[model samples]
Target: MRVVAVLAVVVLAAGCSASEPPPEDPSVDFSADDRKVTAEPFLYCDVQVKDCKRDNTAQVKLEVAPGTPVLVSVPQEVAETPWSVVIQYRTAAGEQMPPETVATFPPNKSSTFEALPPGDGDQLQTVEVKQAGAKLVRDDKGEAAAVSRGVWSAQISPPAA
Candidate 1:
């Protein structure tokens, strides 16, 4: 009888704890249907933009059905920075497609965007967000050039046919 009572108490405690919501993550969020995936910055640079490296191999994989659009939501920090979405697609014949910058948002202009899959049997392979700072990169001749200051990327897998 004592064992049964202890077991009941433990079950009740577990159930109660399970009712609490999980903590929210501070990273890029991708959602489609009822599934959601979050990815931390794969490459983040400081204000100096010199230390553009990440030690951990952090990656997020999201499975999206063909023709379905993936919704991307950035944190406030990213929203306040100038950013653009770069998408890469793969042809049905397994040929790699060129990456395209689908959308570019100015600072404080957007926090959410939709990534549409390529039509006609092509599959979306990857999605990346490149955040650029107001600063420019210097070339060999010290000319200014556009460059990304931070990078966040995610992989998208198509369902098996």
Candidate 2:
């Protein structure tokens, strides 16, 4: 009888502590239908520096299903100041708006932004890396001798469906 009592206690304890996946992030609009959303292709852009030597990336063309939340992120390779973003998309009413700053980040940090889509259907998504707070130092010849460069790459996150 003692053994049975102990087993019952253990079963009750395990049942009480049952693990559950965290509720979907409130900012993200997760789909009710179990359809998987595939990741879009990498759309990258480089610094607009006139004499930029290194090839860099800044933007990516984003596409996701209606209910899938757009996960946008920028990597901080160099310790540069704040980051800003400009996103252009069609409204649910099919009106197109010019690209504008949708979000911004503070100085010298890497972060992610979660944004929801307008409504059901496809939209033209354009994400641009507006500013990374990078500066350039030049020689007397007006040539880039040294650069206070910030390397960053922007892309989608949570690749898994």
- Quick one: best TM-score, which candidate? 1
Question: On residues 22-49, what C-alpha lDDT tens digit does candidate 1 reach at each position?
Answer: 4332478888889898888887776457
Q: Model 2, which residues run further than 4 Å from truth?
A: 1-50, 53-62, 78-80, 118-124, 134-161
Report clash pairs, candidate 1. Answer: none
Lowest lDDT sum, 10 consecutive residues, model 2, at 24-33
For residue 39, model 2's alpha carbon misses the true position, in angstroms, by 12
Candidate no. 1 TM-score: 0.73
| Model 2 lDDT tens row, 1-161 | 99999999999999989989843211111121243232221221234344333333322323354435555444343214455555556766768767666766666664556555456653535544434424556679988632323332233332336
Error of 2 at 159 (Å): 15
What would you estimate as the lDDT of candidate 1? 0.81
